[model samples]
Target: MRNINEGENESKRSPQSIVREVIQGGQSVMSADARADARFVESESVIAENILSILCVPLIIKERIAGAIYVDHRQARHLFSQKDLNFLEAFADQAAIAIENARLYEELEEARTRLSLENESLRREVLVEKHLDSVVGQSEAVAKIQFSIRKAASGNSTVLLRGESGSGKGLVARIIHNVSPRRNGPFIKFNCAALPETLAESELFGHEKGAFTGADRRKLGRFELANNGTIFLDEIGKVTLAIQAKLLRVVEDKEFERVGGTQTIKTDVKIIAATNLDIERAIDQGTFREDLYYRLNIIPLVMPPLRDRKDDIPLLAEHFIRKICRDLGIETKHLEPGVLDLFVRYNWPGNIRELEATLHRAIVMSNGDTITRNDFYGLFGDIVPASPDAGPVPMPGSLLNPVIGKMDITSDIYDEVMSSVDRQLIERALESSGGRIREAARRLGLAR
Candidate 1:
């Protein structure tokens, strides 16, 4: 019951009329010496394969014939018998059932795959909405920031965020990365002020085995990890001049060598640096290099401090409340009538960071649904000592006099005060150097 040339030559295929007749009638088709039979006298299959005998059985499923099984015997006379025909009918019924089951299984698998794709798409949409909503407040200040974030996200330029400590600079940096074309890539971050000089270098550029004492194995650096993505260097100004020199090469050339290794590895990365320190002052004092500053400051973005954007305090308070409640699995809570007013009046020395911390504490300590002024003051009252005549909020350089709002001073007086400050600094350096002029100059980081 076989035809060797069935698929090899389309011209040798059985007549379509006979096959269709068997399928439509749900019956069998049999022939002995089909060439001599009048039914297939002019058929191409008979002449091509030199058919001597043929048989076909209809494949039926649920009382309907869906297909047929065909057999041809070219080397024998009267090869097919009634017994053979009956056996072929049973085989065709089993084959039809198997084919239907396989078709049903394929359909089920396709439906499952389609449903899984839809679920994943919905999950991503929800995540993107929640993430963007994290930046609360609709005030002009926040709106401008959103605009800047969107603009920065469209490009691969180096961005330098400048503001007071705890002013949401890190949050803004993350927003920029998420909205950028490199959103799918890694978003690596490093706090330059958190580690010592030795650890800072190794962590930034990675280290090979035996790079230093206790160095057991090779390590990959943040830049390497962030390859083809973005790296956020928080408190960038705190990094030493030595590390800054190596970092400068990455910004310009996009390459670096691992510590204690000679291999010059290359990477494609975008750098976003943030700092609370006065970079210009650091450059003047020789703690930060000017060339490196320019390279990082190509697209400078100044994050507004909490003091300047007090209008958004109420919105921020509610956002934090919702966020804290959701995280702690607690019911949503509200602020008392006077609590928000007091929040706006008191200067936030710690900026948004301090505000979120205060709200988290209030949510935890409060006994009722509404946070009272007492709950808010219990945490921040003594720390700030709220009063109308209180001094301005302390910032990165608040140790010195207020640069923006100071009393009038004549030119001579200003010069005299600066000279006095400079003299005191120089004398202290000389004393520390044991009165050696060259030693004092070196300590002051002066070439002369």
Candidate 2:
């Protein structure tokens, strides 16, 4: 509230003086005649403004003085009595309550909004972890990959995924993005090898309308769409040198301009690039940028090929079986005893993708609830050895005759012969031990 007249005496005559006194003293201040009172006789404002009566009280709430309230009348002396002071004090108490309630309400609203955002972030994180569980492996190599993924997801560094083509680099990239701090943001993927050189720049950096021939409208690029999120660049080694230069700028500066636009647009995105190419070889050949390679190699994660982690074959096969069955709307199928052994023996050149495809094919061709080695007859070719004859050999030396006769002298001849011998020995032990694996292993002098 402003004073009615502006003057040197205005500050002193204003009710603020009384309010301050009341608040500081934590009590009411009532002056029936302020100008005549000893407290104001020496005050220039009290006399010049003809301040006559005043009533002020502290606004206390919850044992704390929130503020003060004051009322005054200039034309009347002895106008404010103890009764009037009591009335103003009561009103002040009610005002303090209203202020505290409003404050509490605002605080509650703020807490609600904060919790809502936190809950949403947690929800996205949960979804991301669930998606990452699909990595599906229990081998040491797989465990290392998973650990690297967790470590990589905790930061904003650029990641370079090195692996064979079908070794699940793309899946690992998605898992990294999903579990990272930027999980809630968009996850945009671009296959660097999918586009031609002429369109690679426009696809990554966008272009304004009429920037080039056949340009009918403005289009946002992968980087722009991936702002404040993650952008996955698959087959990163396939992009041309010219496009690599643009990618380097965005990695180093976090800024870029559309193909035809002069305005520099900023973006906050986490980049994850995957490739099967030997990056060091490419760099040496001048096919890839060295600086960009260093920038992207901040967090390098190598995906293990399926053959290297053959122990996980059974798990992966079962996982894929259940998935394929569900997708095909059929009953889940189980593998025959020898099928797993066959899978372990063959070298899956196409890695996990090939394994999945092989399983899908086998499942589709299967006529019963179980998939046998015959189901994959032509798939593995000569790798699938023929079952031994039903009759027992007259002597142990006779077993070597058939095995030695069928074997070819090659670099892997030792492993091939041992694998066949091991299979035959285990089969004979199991048959003698009533199909008990532990008894069979014990009879074969092998530890369980």
Candidate 3:
């Protein structure tokens, strides 16, 4: 400690400085040396020097020796001892490791700070775009469909969507179109089942002047108007065999002759046809042509029914509820504690459409803000079992009862029948409450 200031100012920073300092100071008690005597070394080293009867040691960091330390006396036959070298080597090894560890720790902290900043930037980007918000649900089926949609949309291909009624095949078609290069073009839709046979041909192909009895002038059909765009042929399986042949020619050759016209009209359109019916079944039944089916099914996309994706039920239900509320100008509604549990438990035959209708009915009938169990089941009439000991039930008299009530009202008794509705409602409300004053008070919003 006494020579530390002068030793730091030394010109040569080699091991000689350490040797000189140790020889001058009595504190240089080196260890780990096997030598019998000590000698003078360089004076510029920041290391311990040999002392007579002391140990010589090696300085190390992380188990790797960087340099050696010497301690004790010099210039004589066996003047210093060997024990000092051993002590110096042990102390140098520990100090070297400590220094290396501290440097590493600082580096690690810097890396962690940089990683945190990168993660924060990624989170902000996701939120700003609202990307994840639009793609909800984690079902493998949904994820697979998303992957396919992205992979198939890179090229311009004719896509066919097939599924059951109420399934979102049309929606899938729109997603494909929106992700494709033709996204900017108009999307046109037509239902083959909605048009009669006589009008279906005229609907798909434009009509010439005086084409039929109702043809007052030339009118463009769906195909002509959908030029340079995408045309969605919904319910494709239902198109007549005659119309199917016509469609095949149009789809294959990109040209069709209008009804009652000789001129061949060419069209530039991307076709995306959708069908709820099974094309194979229609072909087997001789209702649909095989050649037309193959043309429309080039890039087939099948959408599974909603019941198959039970995991997405809650998300889909909530989405429909919000949509219904928005369209109806009604307040937003929430599910009760067990409402979702019970809803998912039931077999949804009508799929998302059924669940959406249920939620709509519940919301419209709900009196209070929160939707409750009673409000959900209020749409249906519940039948109760009679007591075993009770006699056969008898119908009660009521003026408003459709069958027993008087339908013939003259000018004098007209007012009497109209007032019966008010009295019956109050009596029914009291009966449903089991005659409890406080319960009935709450049901009718009467202050207790």
Candidate 4:
């Protein structure tokens, strides 16, 4: 570098010719003058120059040249010394390691992000497969339900599934029918809620020609169509008292006479009834018969509510959001941690159905490419508000009461009483046990 600078500064040859000579060497070091003409751009070590006495060295580790260092000397009558060249080489070595370290750190960060995204995608795919195949969650309560479904599927037991709406009884019934020996046979579904009371009997049992004003020709009922298969009775609780007795006769003897026809038809179809209503209450109120309840409740499966399986909500939410986005013809968006927070805290009165609907609405309503808290604002207000039965609910009132109604602060109430009891019990327990939380927990029957 010193010899090159000495020749160039004296104009022994043009600066352009010196720059070309430097580029001819497949090395890392170069020097240039103040003319700003091309000095170097590394060959095996490409670099730039025009500031003479500028030392450029390649920072290489293994086979990678991480970076280069360019040191400029602007002083007059200055020329590079052998000692300065040696020092510059050492600086280049140190610079190479530092550059390598920084590059390694960036690569590690990029790898971490890539792994996280891959893992998230794999998790999402598993969830979608489960939801699409209808393989539901594995809560202990669900095991009991499955056991009942097995019994109902194997024999001629008429099942009555009791749970809140959206508890997946319909899905459970379908699973039972699909897994049973009758899967190859026809399986039909009927929603009693969507069926009118006057036409429910006709819907259940086909009417003959001219049986009624609309019966212009013969028609097959759900039972006939689903012959030798399974008949899924959804929302069976909505059936009237008359329909209940008729259903009981079919369950007991498998005999039914079509409307305005004397001939009796026998059906080999299995009956799997589902209801979100309390059949016991319906029976007591004369809307359902006790004998029919006994027959159907023989293979009873009681599905648990959403609050009981809180852990499953996060997985289910993501699964449902993906499915909804696909159905809506939109790109899938992930839920931020805040969205999970909102979902976990809000009580799901409508259960899985409610969560699905909320996510579908949010995906459509979101403005940005990513979903955030702003996307869900005001949407969850209904689920998070104070319960109405929590005394009047403080609504905008008429002449009788004001908008901000006074709260009853009675100590006997649930919130205050529980809080007071909790504090006093904790204090007494802690004192007796000398602040040993484990011992205190033992005394109070609490799990540590």
When 3 and 4 are scored with lDDT, the better candidate is 4
Candidate 1 lDDT tens digits, 1-448: 4666545654456667778778888879888778788988777867777888889999888787788998887767688888888889889988989988876765575455434533543453343332455677778888888888887778888999999999988888878887888887767778899999889988788888799898765667778777878899999999998899999999999999989989999988889999999999999999999999999998888888888899999989988888788878999989865466678777888999999899998899888787766776565465444565767545456545675257567768778777887898788777555456798899879888
Runs of candidate 1 exceeding 4 Å displacement:
1-132, 379-448
Angstrom error at residue 369, model 1: 1.0
Whole-model Cα lDDT per candidate?
Answer: 0.81, 0.81, 0.65, 0.68
Residue 240 alpha-carbon offset, candidate 3, angstroms: 0.5
Better of 1 and 4 by lDDT: 1
Tell me which residue pairs clash in candidate 4.
32-52, 40-47, 41-46, 41-47, 42-45, 42-46, 42-47
- On the 0 to 100 scale, the lDDT of residue 33 in model 4 is 40
All candidates: CA RMSD (Å): 20.3, 15.4, 28.5, 32.3
lDDT of 4 by residue, 19-123 (tens): 344344425554444334253433222223334455555555655654444455544323555666678778877777776786677567545543554354345
Clashes (N, CA, C under 3 Å) per candidate: 0, 1, 48, 7
Residues 179-249 of candidate 3: C-alpha lDDT, one tens digit per residue: 77767665567788998987989878868779899886566667876677777788988888899999999
Error of 2 at 303 (Å): 0.9
lDDT of 2 by residue, 1-448 (tens): 2225444454444645566777788988778888778876676756766778877788898989978876767777788777787878788888988989977875675455435544654554442234557789888998898889999899889999999989998778878877898988877777899989879888788777789998765666778777888888999999999999999999999889988889898999999999999999999999999999999999999888888999999999999899889879999999866667778988899999899899999999988898876787587676734445555446655757866787677999888879987898888786566456898899889996
Highest TM-score among the candidates is held by which one? Answer: 2
Model 3 alpha-carbon drift over 4 Å, by segment = 1-136, 378-448
